[model samples]
Target: MSDRIVESCRMCESSDLESVLDLGSTPPSDNFLTLEQLNKSETYYPLRLVCCKSCGLSQLSYVVDRETLFNPDYPYESGTSKFFRDHFEEMAASVTGKLNLAADDLAIDVGSNVGILTAAFQRNGVRSLGVEPVGRLAEKANMAGAETVHAFFDPDIGQKVRDSHGAASVITATNVFAHIDDLNAFVETIKILLKPTGVFVSESPYLLDLVQNLEYDTIYHEHLSYYSVAPMRSFFDRHGMEIIDVHPVDMHGGSLRTYVAFKGAHEVSESVGRYLANEKEQRLQDPEALKKFGAKAAAHKAELFEFLYELKREGKRIVGIGAPAKGNTFLNYCNIGPEILECLTEKAEAKVGLFAPGTHIPVLGDDFLENEQPDFGLLLSWNLKNEIMNNLSAFSAAGGKFIIPIPNIEII
Candidate 1:
């Protein structure tokens, strides 16, 4: 099937699911089009959010085919951003130090795009391997000196890796755990690959942050689940694993870094309890709270669209500063096409000449800002506003302003 509506909760198999936010239908956010492919038709899937009453897991109501979503031409690369490179480096150091991993120990990164984290693990004195689905990305990682297996991670692949490199001391899935459609199978694969006392690390955008900050733009087909502490704790427990620690990091708006291990293998930190308590206090699982968040998101979208429309009517030229996957969600939801945004400027060479998935706006290189000097730039990658704006100081110095769209639309 190209796509299908989900009938039950992905984690708990619960049928008591309630719809919260419906962003209507949208093309796959990361399907950047080549100049020749733009003439062809595009497939749009239902973009809606639902919450499971049984397990309190928030997820997309529809599941796009993995083959279509993770096509060979997938353009995302983690090493393109220095912030992410440093983040991965720090992650490697922390995980190695905390787990006391030695040079003989193996560290495996699942869905390791271009092996940024895998290389970082090597730098921190651990034998590292990456499991990536994209062939080109796997080849790139191998060429860059990080060994990688090009296949979608599964129990068979897990066992093969274990046989070849021995069981891993630690397995990491950064910003990748949410893309999984079968959590149970994924955890089982983790079970096969990890040693008895091994830890599993996962980092994803927190559901609480998405709701509180009105980051509706992060909701897309690739991200099947919007994770919170309660559901995650219960899900891991069901698989005989327990969350030992939770750390809130300032990345991707707000993300939670969770460390999980086999039951009784590690001492649970108080941070887990604190996060669970906070989720309870904030009514993170309540359908009413999520509904309220939906209402606020709708209002915010209207306000932002009007603001951009007014700026356009005033004869101001505007272009998007970044063409992130989340930016496609925002652009399509707002219906801001080339009419409003002349083009989007990007630093990633893979996307520089491509077009935004749904909006069809041309993506130019970073030099577009300096060469064309649009009157305003919409900061599509608002989460990295500081880094992006700092890098484009010349644009601001030339009297070009930036419009930050999320949390609240502000022009600076």
Candidate 2:
């Protein structure tokens, strides 16, 4: 009955924290279970956001433990989206060229899901290694011929990597940087692993973009910290590193691809200065902006539930589309259970055979939408609305409505 122990900000260890938003209590997104497991009492954990006054880092303080986040049979395959794979390839080429990497140089990827970008490095004859915490994903990366380490990346592991691979010429984390609970430890690891001339590159959904785009669904327990150029620069500077270059990539809605290097080893690019200026001008660090974002998200939840409830009252069959991780946050936040939606549809066979995390909504194959002919489909993965709608042209032709909730509420 007591409150769970709270985690301190990895950067500042400031207990001076306040909740920005509480998506109520919810189960971890990746804890999809068997039907028998479903019969047992389900457990829920708090999905709360907190802002650190000292460090200016927005984070979730509860640690759900890594086992819940990265299961052996984690169903999300990075290769499922060709669009993401292509982006990884292009990114590898661009960064390699920019860093002027030699054929013999080594590249290390932390949490390299399926080794997509690492494979790109291997193609150019650069020795590549991937460190993945999840057993299944690490196994997949190893099978793909990338030297895979089946463990989490931290200061110790970073040292081991440097000992073996002779200091990575380049280190990268794609959509994986935000999951670490220990920002100081993570940066220390990156510093120890990099060669004197090595660059640490990361791509993460920008906090600015998240607020501007109303991407409240991106708030999951796993993503403990959100990043922007401002906080990141300060975080790295403490460890004798410099933000050298930055490029905004269009993956995962909108993301910032950042490059950093050892202190005084590389020229701090003008882009870093420009980005900091922009952040100051826009007041991204202002606490009021974040407070406003929390309000906007609540309004979105209210609008979405009102519309869906009206549909249910009309005796219309409503089904959800794509059981994405973000969808779990939205569903739990809005209290949308099977009563509101019969079930959800997913393209992946693994997810289709399982149930949604918190709501326990039975996840069915895409055929469910095609055959059963739902009156309205709530596009849970609104980020991929264009792709899902295009693929479900048959449903649209059959007079089905698609409801997308985020940025703008629209029915197509």
Model 2 poorest ten-residue lDDT run: 1-10
Q: How do all models score by TM-score?
A: 0.99, 0.95
lDDT of 1 by residue, 3-40 (tens): 67899999999999999999989999999999998999
Q: Please, what is the whole-model Cα lDDT of each candidate in the order they appear?
A: 0.94, 0.83
Per-residue accuracy of model 2 over 281-395 as CA lDDT, tens digit each: 8767666668888898999899989989999999999999988888898898998999999999988777877888778899999999889999999998887788789999999
Prediction 2 global C-alpha lDDT: 0.83
Assess candidate 1 and give its lDDT: 0.94
In candidate 2, list every pair of residues with a backbone clash.
Answer: none
